[model samples]
Target: MASRTAIKRLTVEYKRLQTQPPPYIVAKPLESNLFEWHYILTGPPDSPYEGGEYHGRIVFPNTYPYAPPAIRMITPSGRFATDTRLCLSMSDFHPDSWNPMWSVPTILTGLLSFMLEDTQTTGSIVTTAAQKRQYS
Candidate 1:
């Protein structure tokens, strides 16, 4: 059972996405359970992820807003591990590291920006030099 606040938050987020969608963010639940959201995000133009749309999922705990949700990419983004959980500074990767002030919009914005980076991890696809050329 979800608390009123959590339900309201989900509703508000859902409505906001419907009107003015994000340039690189499209999210939906894995099932009828609105708490789990799967997303597809495109990298900003001219970045390593340029012209690419990556897929991931955000699992919001029933006690969400109080605790940051867990985020993982189901599809291969080449930026993050595919299927394996990530260790983002703000993710439940380290629940104690979460910040209360952070919101969905902020997280989404960070995600859009982060994919441009080539992290020091295996299974991450380095955007080809040719791809970077068209990023202009």
Candidate 2:
């Protein structure tokens, strides 16, 4: 069952996202499930991901704000494996560092910032710049 706090927070965040959407990213909750969100991310310019529009989902826990959500990139970005959960600090992989104050916009921006980095992790992939550019 979803906590009232979780539902309320998600609702407020959804409205904020709709009214004043963030740059390079747009997201919304699934009509049937508030815990499941779909998002579109425009690849940052000057990076291998430039000119690409990546789609993915964020699965929030009922105990969200206390527990981070799972993040998966569905697109074939050479930086991370498709359909695999990313090992990011803001993701469920590192809950200890998560801040309850961080909102959906913060998470998406952080995700995009991390995507531009060349960090290696469990779900991260290693490919040549050319390959990444071509795949983007």
Candidate 3:
């Protein structure tokens, strides 16, 4: 079960996102579960993912913001395996580095940045720019 503090924090964050949304990304909690958020990222300009609209979800731990979230890209971006948990600093892969101060926007932005990188991580895929464009 999620703590009251986690629920409250997530509620505030959700409100802030709805009113003062970030660029290239839109996210919202699932109607039935505050711990699960769905997001759509407009691929950053001038990158291999440009013009792509990638969809994904984040599942926050009961302790949230303190424990980091599990993120998975559902889109076939050619840079990441669809439906696989990404290994990132702000993700479950690096709990020790997670900052409780980080917000939902931070995670989305970080994911976008990571998507543009060519470095290969456990859940990441290596593909040509052409292949990425094709997937886009």
Q: What TM-scores do the predictions have?
A: 0.79, 0.95, 0.95
Reference-based TM-score, model 3: 0.95
lDDT of 1 by residue, 27-76 (tens): 76656888888787876665666667778888888877778788887766
Q: Clashing residue pairs in candidate 2, if any? A: none
The local lDDT score (0 to 100) that residue 69 gets in candidate 1 is: 84
Ranking by TM-score: 3, 2, 1
Residue-level lDDT for 56 in candidate 3: 93
Instruction: Report the CA-based lDDT of candidate 3 relative to the real structure.
Output: 0.90
Model 1 TM-score, 2 decimals? 0.79
How do the residues 48-108 of candidate 2 rate in per-residue lDDT, one tens digit apiece? Answer: 8888888989999999878899999998878889899988888899999989888888999
What does candidate 3's lDDT look like per residue over 11-58, in tens digits?
A: 999999999888899999999999999999887788877889989999
Clashes of each: 1, 0, 0
* Model 3 pairs whose backbones collide: none
lDDT of 2: 0.90
Rank candidates by lDDT, best first: 3, 2, 1
Error of 1 at 71 (Å): 0.7
- The residue ranges of model 3 lying beyond 4 angstroms of the native Cα positions read none
